[model samples]
Target: MSEITPDLVRHLGVLARIQLSDAEVERLTGQLDVIVDNIAKVSRVATPEVPATSHPIAMSNVFRPDVVGDMLTSEQVLQNAPDAADGRFRVTAILGEEQ
Candidate 1:
């Protein structure tokens, strides 16, 4: 098993440009050691016989197939607009932007 020491934590902090006190370095060392040990345990159990998977359960796409259907014409759609011009909907200028 790999060991996570305070010196290693301090070196990581330096690489990450983070300033960690002695107390923080000591605390992180213990936490990282636990994490590393747990990963090692998982590695031992995940053998060649067991297939690798991203999720615990099977997953698949649940969406319906895309199929083109009847669509309204541009004039038909613009008929309901409060204001339209040049075959398009016209709205007031926003954010002081030029047309």
Candidate 2:
């Protein structure tokens, strides 16, 4: 079991960029001590005999066969555009620099 003191909690808060009060740090230190101890016990039980499995259920590649589909005409593709010019969608300048 690891001891989580006020200093440890304060150091952790600094690393995580969190501002915690003295009272909050003290409370968290106690809670973190218990959490760390529980994790240590769990780690001890996880032995080499047990094969490491990333997921609980079996998974297979869920993919669809690549096949060519119907194509759309240039006029049909530009029909829904709010602003179109010269068979292309006309959009406002996205950058300050001139193209």
Candidate 3:
């Protein structure tokens, strides 16, 4: 097990721009030691055969057959528009006259 010293915690506090009282430093030392020990335990359990994975289950692409279907005519699409011209939808000018 690795030991976490008060001086290390004090230095970390300075680097992180955080202020820690003596009591906090003493408490954090034990806490940090436990965290490091737990990580080491996990590392020891890991093996070459155990493949690394971000997710638990295997995944594959789910897709449907590509079948062409009926499409709408230009007039059918433009029928609902408030304003249309030359087989297209028209809108008010957004830019000022400066251009």
Candidate 4:
């Protein structure tokens, strides 16, 4: 027995606010049945004994030790700015918005 029917497809179209013709309804009924059957088959194969995974292989994060480095002062960084104000870079207002 098929789980998807024309009436069910019509109801789904109505819920989704879609205007489906009779031909479309009939076509979708068969297509949706195949999709639902595939999902059921996959579900039956996914037993609790098998673990779920996002990837086929295990993964680990690599990290390096943090070290202090030479840095530029605020005044030295601001020297390259086209516009600066209040110790920060200033940009023109966008879309008539101001902060």
lDDT of 4 by residue, 1-99 (tens): 799999999999999999999999999999999999999998999999989999898987778779989999999999999999999999987765554
Runs of candidate 2 with Cα error greater than 4 angstroms are none
- What is the lDDT for 79 in model 2? 92
Q: How many clashing pairs per prediction, in order?
A: 0, 0, 0, 0
Task: Order the numbered candidates by TM-score, best leading.
Answer: 2, 4, 1, 3
User: Mind giving the per-residue lDDT tens digits that candidate 1 earns over 1-99?
Assistant: 559989999999999999999999999999999999999999999999999999998999999999999999999999999999999999987865554
lDDT of each: 0.94, 0.92, 0.92, 0.94
Q: Which stretches of candidate 1 lie over 4 Å from their true place?
A: 69-72, 75-99
- Report clash pairs, candidate 2: none
The candidate 1 region of ten consecutive residues with least summed lDDT is 90-99
TM-score of each: 0.68, 0.72, 0.54, 0.70
Steric clash pairs (candidate 3): none
Off by over 4 Å in 4: 62-72, 92-99
Residue range 13-44, candidate 3, lDDT tens digits:
99999999999999999999999899888899
RMSD of 2: 2.5
The total of clashing pairs for model 1 equals 0
Give the runs in model 3 whose Cα sits over 4 Å from its true position.
59-99
